[model samples]
Target chain A: MNTRYIFGIIITVVLLSVNQAFIQYWLAQKKHDANTINIAGKQRMLSQRINAEFYRLEKESASPHLLKKLVAEWKTSHFKLQSKDKSNKLVPITNSEIRLALKELNPNIEFIESQLNNIGKASLNLSLINQNQNSFLPKMDKIVKSLEKISDKKLQFIIKTEFFLFFMSLIILILEVVFIYIPIEKSLNLANAEISKKNEDLKQALTSIGKKNRELEQITYITSHDLQEPVRTINSLVNIFKIKYARDFDEEGIKMLRYLDTATVRMRDLIKDLLDYSIIGKKREKTKIDCAEILEIISKDLALKINETKAKITWGRLPKILGIEAEIRLLFQNLISNALKFQMKGHQPKIDIAAIEKKDFWLFTVSDNGIGIESKNVEKIFSIFHRIHSKDKFEGTGIGLAHCAKVVDIHGGAIWVESELGKGCTFFFTIKKDQNKIVGYEQQTELYITS
Target chain B: MNNKLNSILLVDDDEATNFIHQFVIQDHGACKHIVTKLDGQEAFDYLTTPNESGLPSPDIIFVDINMPKLDGWGFLEKYESEFGSNSSKIIVMLTTSLNKYDKERAESMNVISEFRNKPLSPEILDEIVEKYFTNKHMVQ
Candidate 1:
């Protein structure tokens, strides 16, 4: 719970407990007050009975022992009215009216007791005894009435306090419901609604992005495929025209035709490269690709080139990676061909390929003794159509490295080059071990974007 | 070099491509009679119908892979069901698609003689004719 809620609960519990304790104390005091009132009322009856017994001794010959017993009982009852308990110690009386009534009765009770002490003696004063008894009875009666009034007042106070405590507890409960509980519930509901709305929005955005990606892929494939036919036709017609009408064309016209043929050929290559680039990641299947075997195939394919250049291509033992075989083959083809193509003049190309196992992926390096790239242009080489050298020097559609980058990216890896001018270059790329877990382009895009 | 074919059929969706192939085949002296169709559907109809001369089917059929109506794969399936490998016609799968699956599929089919890329050249045409028709010409 939050700090505020915890504090609220603690305070509510403390207040209710304190109120309950006060009610309990007051109820115990109510019982003590009832006992004090009962003793005070009994003192009044004792005083009257003692006076009547004294009158019987004086006129109708009552027993002195009964009178003495009545006197003793009267004293004990009177003491108990003001005392704390049977110990007969005077309690601190809080009600001044009952205290004054008991104080006035004390002297009359003492005088009657003194007259009764000489009951069987000749020194007994009957008249004095009658007078003191008469005064003590009314005084004790006044004390009894005052005690009842105080008890009644105390009982009423206890009842009123109990009702107040109940009302306050109800108010606290209502306040907590209105201020704390209801608002917490409402905010919880609002937060839930907002979260669901955001989820819905994200879902819609993802579907739309998927749809747009599919549409763009279709457009790219269709446009490149359809454009190839016209370019091929142009190339073929130009060849036919040169053969059929060579006598009519001058030197300049022939040269112009040659330029047209070169342009058409370049356009065709660019379209083919674009189509190839767009087709990457279209098929999302991962299988065990033996890099060593793929290297063997590439070696066989480039055997003539290797012989012609007398280039020595060597590789360490390679590992099998989980990836699309075609994509991985294309990646290796581009990197190795690039290494061979950028060789220095009169220098035998020395290519070394090796794979190092990392924590989560295999890092492969293709190092070549070739005319390496400049440091500034290394990053730009992976972009589509971004060529560092002029078309006259390097013959390429400039899509090879871009294709390599896309393949590595879709396999959940990274590709980069470390090179210097006029020296050898090393192209490093990684293939994730868990390539089968890669779902598709959408997930791959999210992965790279986050990384 | 007496390895010229009697006839050749070009099945493709693009009219320009068909024209270029026709021009190239004629210029190479590979065939005297050349026939072209827009898609696999027209090629199927032509192969099934009886001609006026009642000559046998063309010696070679160059079929493009990607087409609007009834693609090369569809035509191949229909042709195998209809002819059942008894026919002597040579079928070449010709297309611009560099997809490896298409080449593999063509390689797996017994009816297909060869799979070649588009923009057929004179050198490639000569090689095909030499490889398949030269021995036949000697036997004849």
Candidate 2:
């Protein structure tokens, strides 16, 4: 995977973890808050009930039956308070489980209620205790005192449960902030670092390209202006020799003169080709290109050679792409001409063309059943002026493949040849899909200028 | 039309180029004397030799721009400052380059009569012969 994608994934995971932690912390806080409110509310209700019971006791002192009923009511209320509180009090660990445990205390609450009823029955025998008023008062006070004990116990339980919940919630919040949120920040910083490194690499590449551009400019100037002088000298000398020495020359000298003239013409053609190679595709431009049309154009351009060699060219499906059209055409022209040039002795010249699409890229193959190259010279073929065959054997500038390589490189692609001697040769190259939808195919780069 | 201009000088580094030019001058059958040098040094030395009698100094010197040791530009430098301006010789820049820089350098020297590209043709020789050898009549 690309480094950027990896960094993106890490940042995403960190953010998700942070989000999950925040949600969990919020839920924990909500649970703790609800429990505290429930506990406090339960305590307040029990306190209010006890206050009412005490006031009622002070008002009704003469009626034993009424006093007995009031005592029974207070006992029942106290038991209910203890039972409800045991269930609802701040369950620090698990409030729902505590609620279930409080159900188990129901029977205990009922037993306490029974004890209250008995207390009511005993209070009705106040005639025996009224002989000592203080004794009867103390008797009623004991019944009330038992109710207060239960209420106080429930209040203390709720206070402890609520305190524990608050502490646990604080711990969960701190853990979430430190472990989840902090790592997210760190991941983002790492992504920033990766981006910065890529940026620096890009800057260095551009600087190097700038230096290369200057060198290329100098080479172009020297080649166009300096090397040309010698060829012109040779041309003018040829003209002079023909004018001055034609009368003295024999048939051999005349033949030599023709060879000299032909050689000079060939040199001129080679120099022009080299100049085109370096100059074309230097400033890469994107444009819509139809491969079939470009091929037709090249065929038309090389019609004379094709007719001379009686070469048969066949093309497979060629998908149109966005590229520099002229350079692409030159690439095809060179490869096709090379195929035509290196033909088997007596076999009919035949070339096979094929292409396939692979995920936003196109692979093109130009194969010929001509003279195949050795494996060792595969890499050497693309180098400037490198020729497997000598000039005497074949007529070539030895720059066609070099020009094609340059053109493919400008498209952010690569061109390579696979071949075995006497078998055949196939040229492969890849062209990327240009999204900007431009159709610029200008070809005027000057890559080579020979003497 | 007989004038005091009877001699001509040719300066170039390449012996073959000088030989060809000398052949062309002889073929044209004009100037009484044609002094050839391998570089600008010999040409400058021959020019600065003080002459008491006004036997015409090389009436015109054709200097090739590219040379070893003393180039045409260097010869021009000595010709002006070391030798006085009132001399009889006229200088012409002969080079293989038609580059603007070479032309500009020649013009700035102030000693040059004209700039010409090399592999001098019969036409160029004729022009030179007519310009300096006033005594020579046109070939019929």
Candidate 3:
């Protein structure tokens, strides 16, 4: 929503991502360490059990001669202890052939201990006991070796797995830092910078526009007001010249004086038009004005020009409008005046004043039978200080139509002209219809009574 | 006859305008000595003053709207209240400005004659002069 909020969110997001990752990695490492330690403990316990069993077996199997004597004793003890399991009836000891053989082989095994004495029977007894047997000691040792080997391999595998996970977690941390956190942070900074730059640019643009607007306003004021001083001075100077030097001058001097007078008047008109142009936007003087009455008044004022041209004005119903009465009068006066001024040398000006019903506005046309404008000069006539006709042809500073344009702009209307050279011209303009005032009442009461 | 006939006063700041008015009035062979004052206050003082010699009391006043001090409208505002008998004086508005507010205000005044435009035309001149002439002759 704001710079501060964006910064706060970025910090929040970054911290959350880092902290969550840290927490996840830490938990994973803890789980791994716990499993590793548990496995190590189980391996140690297994090693201990294997060592104890191997030691006990080693102690018992240390002396072979003693082992044989113990074995014979264990056999006799085993026979007596196993009597219930196997003794349905007892056979004499000398009657069993296996025993007879064992007795022969043992003839001197117990009695003889000489260095060269014949010990074949003892050897034979040893062979019989060794039949169908594998030694427990070597097998147990091999088992222990294999178990140790397996646990060692398991420990190595677990360690490697934990190392790989540790490195993977680190890589993930690095990648998150590089790809997610760092770039997003960078982008966030860039976003803030870009917006800040744009904001600054916008502010600068607005500030300059405001400054320019004020300067333009000030220039307009100075041009309209301060510029009047020199014009008034020139007018006063002309008056003084006419009073003091008029009698002394001959016909040419008088003609020059008249020329100066016309030029000065043109200058005055120009200034007034410029002032009117500038003030149009600032002026908001609008009241309910009867448009038809204004037209009738303009008709009266332009009577002399119309008479000179021998023009006839026909009218379709002109509706009442919302405008400053004086300005609208001036607007109509200018249009009608132009029509009267631009008459063909011999032709009587036949001007028609008519209003058209438009969708959103009232479109009015003032068509003339005067010598018309060229298509190109129609636009030229509305420019400041631009005159299509020379002074000898038409009298104006070309500011009149410009002023009309400005007024129409103030009223939110479009003013355009359609003309063919040497034929006739029609000036079309649109003004918003004031829906607040009804046309029927004003027309019936006014048109009937006034005419 | 006495109520219908009275002296008229002309109050103005511009000498030329008043002179032209006097000339026009005299050209028509009306009264020779129409009382004139430089300002509204002078006219007021004259009207309310004692009926002294050379200070003929005014029956009507032609007041120019724009003046230096105590303008025509201002004079009328004070006249009706302070000197109640002065209300009988016909007060005419003479101004260049056709401001509707001024016209309405002038019409609403107690002793107002009518709101009219300046450079009073020959037609109005003859009409007003004829009425006052008969009244003047009757008084004589």
Candidate 4:
């Protein structure tokens, strides 16, 4: 769009300069033609002066010096006017009539010059000088008239050529505006309309997403409240029956009651974890959190389990990062707890936590010496409710890793695991340095609702 | 003992929850008379009008948040407008909602005395009575 205008202006400037140079050259030629005509006119007057002076010398007996000077002046001017040599002094003779006339005057000028050279020694021919001067005057007049006509023709040609060049430049300018500039403007308008239409579509999509998020939130609340209500009643009623009718129950009935108790306890824990996962990003604001401090708090919370397993926990210098405090704490807690829980039978657990500074974020790792997961099931660990071990072997709802995944995602990062069936596992995750770059679901929903 | 409450009101949409709460209150012997209503609207109507049994005004009203025909918040609004602020009656919000927003909402209102979870036990009822009422033995 911008280059078209620049190219059009450049072409116009080139055309104008070409016309200017041509016109200047022609004007300079016209000045030279006028100079030549002035000299031809002067030659005619000098011829008459020489003739009259000679007549005066014949009758009054004056010095021949004055007559000689006039002849000398007339000879030089005639030579300059009638010379056919192609040099600076040569005037262009275009008309054949003017050429023949200048040729006739040349001989007369030479005859007068030869007579003046024999000043006092020979008698001067006064009658012959008069006849030659008369002939020279008429031809010089015709030559001057011809030179004037030629100059006028040159001037007319220059004017007509200048008009033609100017008209051509105007046509080119109009064509440039019609083809280059107008079309560019039209395409720019079209692009602008397209961009605004896309913006409108994006706004509508954001609104619909906000509505969906709100509906999902409502469903979570309903599950937590309404669904848990009946479960709580059942659990409590069983407890009440157990307390009131313990003596009446046989061994088989007692076993069934204990099974019911276990099932209800597991169901409650499942519901609580599901609620916690769904409520991850309800707090949209982020704050600076010290990872070392959070790890210390988590280790203290798991002191009982750590003591029972005789575990050795150590960490390198951790960083202060921008994230939701609770979510980040939960992330570390889950990773550390998993490291403590999944262990090799009768083996001492050793866990290490460390962080490395990357270009745009901080990479963290939690490695543990435990009963490692199989390589095939490594990718499946972060999925909700995906457990590799049976319920009889491990006590877990398989939600901890999935919760860690959610936390990392909200912080604009990723989570993955590297493990083998017999070797220890290393869990890796990233946290962005700038919290504002995080486009978590909660932030987008809040923006749509508030705006 | 002055620790005993004169009259208590129990409001909930769930029949089992109200039954359990009423039984616990009765078992604790915390109050002289106990009134049970199906929902917040029925409880509000019962409190506003004179009863056939000629029961006294309740000292503590346990209102559940989620109910049909005027929920806990709606009933509170109507009660506040009718009785005005600084009423002597203690209003406790009882529900099964685990949402933090609901707890924050209950705390923000001045008319609500406390927020408690569902299935009120005998120990919880005894604590409420001991906290609000004067126990002459403790004073001695």
Candidate 5:
């Protein structure tokens, strides 16, 4: 959009500059034409003055010296009339009638000059001189008339040229407005309408998605609450039956009862894990949390597991970040527990936890020397109920890593793992330092709601 | 161990949960008497009305959150406003809800003494009796 405006402005400036240059050139040409016309008019006036001097010489008794002075003045005016300089280059006139008239006037000027010279040379008959001067009078009048006609024609030509230029400039301006400015404005309006429409559609989609998400959360809460009642009943009733009737039951019956007890207990644990996974960030209390403190709490919680696995856990200096204290604690707890639980046979687990500050966030890594996951199962491990090992081998409802992912996601971060089979695995995650700043998909939903 | 109280009250909408809870309490022998109410309203009625035999009020009341007529929160509101300030009866909220909001609400109310998940086991019942009832004598 900005580029379009800039391009339009550049084109308009160039066109206006070209039009101004043309107008200036035409105005200069008109000024030159006026100069030429003024010179021609001066020449005609000089011829009339010379004629008057000749009449004055004939009528009044003048001394030979005065006649010589008048003749010299006439010669000077005649020479000036046809004087040529750098700017005054004589060219043939364009109009044929004006050219022809000027041709007649030139010879007459020559004839008059010769007559004056003859009178100056001898004090001859006065009547004959006077007759020649009378003839010069008519020729001077004719030359003046022709010069006036040429000046009028030049004035008319200049006015016509200016009018034509004015009309052409107006046409160009109108064409530019019609073809360029108006179309561009119309398309801009159309594009704006389209963008607003798309924005409205996006808003509607986000609102509906938020509504569906809310409904799903409600259903999950209700389902988990209601389902636990029966499971708990089954568990209690099973326990009561074993306590009351264990002596009468056979060996096979005892094994079946124990299986029932195990199934009920596992079901209960599954339900509990599911509930925990669903409520990860439901009640977030954001504040400045010290990562070192949270890690200490997690280590204490896993003291027994750490002892059983003989895990040599080490950590670097952790930074204080703005986040939900409980969620961050849970995130560390899960990773540490997983590291302790997935150790190779006869291998003491070596777990390293550290945080490195990046440009806008902190990158945390929990690396473990454990029975590493296969490349293909790295992504699958984080999904709910995607267990890579059988329950007999590794007991889990497969919701721990999923819960960790949720915690990372709610904080506007990403979590992933880099692992090779039979070697070690490193789980990396990022947390933005600014917890109050909303980011990513959550920000979009927030905008939709507020708007 | 000697029975900790004269009577106990259980408030829950589900009969099966109440049954299991009653069995757990009976097995633990924490109280001499146990009364079961289907919902919060029934439990409230049982508490407000006087018995012809002149029995003492239950030492502990266990109420569930989600019910048809009246919920645990509604019961707590009523109980606190009416017979709350001087009564020595302990109120323990019991529910299958894993929602943090419910737990937080329970924690904020001064009348509520404990929040426990269902269905109650003998060990949990014994712990509650030992902490609230047995500790009362020690404090005195």
Candidate 6:
């Protein structure tokens, strides 16, 4: 089950337990009130019984022993009602009104006891009999009436208490439903609706972005293919002209033709590089690739340049990773070639390639002792066609490092450089251990460019 | 590089590319007869006509991929259907497309013997004639 439902159940159980405890306390109080009413009624009955015995003794003029026993019983009943001896007394009425009624009845009870005592002393005194028949019997009746009133009042108090408890229980139920349950349910529904709406918006944005990316790829592919034909035609015609009709042109005409030829070649390179940049992750073949093997191949490919420049290249142990072998080779080639191309005047280029095994990837570093880049141009170096040096100074299309950046990004990694102007530079890039964790080329390319 | 083939055909949409390629072929002197067609449709029509019309079927046909009337793939499809039995004539696909898919398709097709990038040179012409025509001629 969901946790929300479990939490709600827990809250409901707690509220119900609290309500049940309150009702139990009220019920216990009601039970005590009923016992108090019962005790007061019993006291009223005893007082009435005593009054009847007194009348009987006055009229019959016989059975003095029975009269004395009855008098003793009345006295005992009165003491029990008052409960002066708390330990031995049975009835313990703690209500203030009941105690007040008992106090008022105490004087009447004492007078009746004294009158009975007098009758016992003089068994045939007419005046004592008259006093008992008139004043004492009426006083006993008043005491019984007061006890009945106290019982009635207790019954009314119990009825009011029960009604109040029922009303309080209903209010508590409404409060729990209104304050806790309803608001929580309403907010939960609102949050669900909001999340679904945001999800839909995100889905639509992703779809549109994917469509735009595919369109851009198609446009790049077609433009590069179409653009190359004319460039090739111009280069071919110029070559034929330079070969077949070179003696027919003046010096200036020949120089202009050479310039045209150079421009056409550069344009072709630019178009080819653009196409390569666009198709970074279009189709990839992933295999277990050894960084050491790739570096060996790159060194062999650049052997002539290395010999001419007298550059020294060394490497430490490299880890075996999963990637597209050709792309990795290209990446290594570009960085090593850049190192060779950007050497300081009369300085033998020293390039070092190494890989460190990280938790999820291999961090590869290519350090070169060449003319390093300025700090501000570090980010700009990876942007397409962003050339910091003029073509005369540095013969490059400026897409080499950008292509390397794209390749690293396709492998779900980051690329950056730490360099100081006129000093040596080190370029660091990562390659994921698992090729299956590659990101989409379009998204990663955008991130690489922006970041 | 003695003349190895009787004739060769060049199919391309771009006039400049055809002109330069024809110049290279003529400069190499690899074949006595050379024909240029504006598109694949013109080349197809020229090839399918009766051989007795004083025009011999070229031993090699270089077909450009992007054309106005009929593209290289379209011509290849029609050419295979029309001339499937003519195994002696070789068809080579030529284009400036660097797309790997195009290369793979050209390699996979039975009618196409080779795929070449555009702007053919005299050395390439000489190589093609020596590789394909000279051996066959010597065998005959």
Chain A TM-score relative to the true structure, per candidate? 0.57, 0.52, 0.49, 0.58, 0.65, 0.62
Interface RMSD of each: 11.0, 6.3, 12.6, 8.4, 10.1, 9.9
Determine which window of 10 residues in candidate 3 chain A has minimal summed lDDT.
A442-451
lDDT of 2 by residue, A227-342 (tens): 55577567666766886798799999999998998888787677667666656665456688999999888889989978887889999789998887888888998999899889
How does model 1 fare in lDDT? 0.82
Candidate 6 lands at a TM-score of: 0.68
Candidate 4's displacement at residue A319, Å, is: 0.3
Better of 1 and 3 by DockQ: 1
**Model 2 lDDT per residue over B72-109, tens place:** 77888888887655455678788756456677777776
**Ranking of predictions according to lDDT:** 1, 4, 6, 5, 2, 3
**Per-residue lDDT tens digits of candidate 4, residues A313-352?**
9998999999999999999999988888888777888999
lDDT for model 5 comes to 0.76
For candidate 2, state the interface root-mean-square deviation in angstroms to 1 decimal.
6.3
Clashes of each: 0, 17, 1, 0, 0, 0
> Could you estimate the TM-score for every candidate?
0.60, 0.45, 0.48, 0.62, 0.66, 0.68
| Alpha carbon deviation, residue A362, candidate 1 (Å) | 2.4
Fnat of the models, one by one? 0.35, 0.04, 0.00, 0.17, 0.35, 0.39
Q: In model 4, which regions exceed 4 Å deviation? A: A1-221, A440-451, B1-7, B26-33, B48-54, B81-85, B134-140
| Higher-lDDT candidate of 1 and 4 | 1
Q: In candidate 6 chain A, where is summed lDDT lowest over 10 consecutive residues?
A: A442-451
Question: Against the true structure, what is model 3's DockQ?
Answer: 0.10
lDDT by residue for model 1 over A41-93, one digit each (tens)?
77767777877777778786656888788778888777666554544433335
Candidate 6 ranges with C-alpha deviation above 4 Å: A1-177, A439-451, B1-4, B48-53, B73-87, B99-101, B108-111, B135-140
**Which regions of candidate 5 are displaced past 4 Å?**
A1-173, A440-451, B1-9, B31-33, B40-61, B65-93, B97-115, B132-140
Please report the candidate that would top lDDT against the real structure.
Answer: 1
Maximum-DockQ candidate: 6
User: What digit string (tens of lDDT, one per residue) describes model 1 on residues B1-140?
Assistant: 34378889999988888888898888888798999999889999988888787744899999988787888988988989988865688898887766676777889999999899888888889889888988888798
The segments of candidate 2 whose C-alpha lies over 4 angstroms from its true place after superposition are A1-169, A172-198, A217-221, A234-273, A282-297, A300-308, A316-326, A355-362, A389-397, A432-451, B1-140
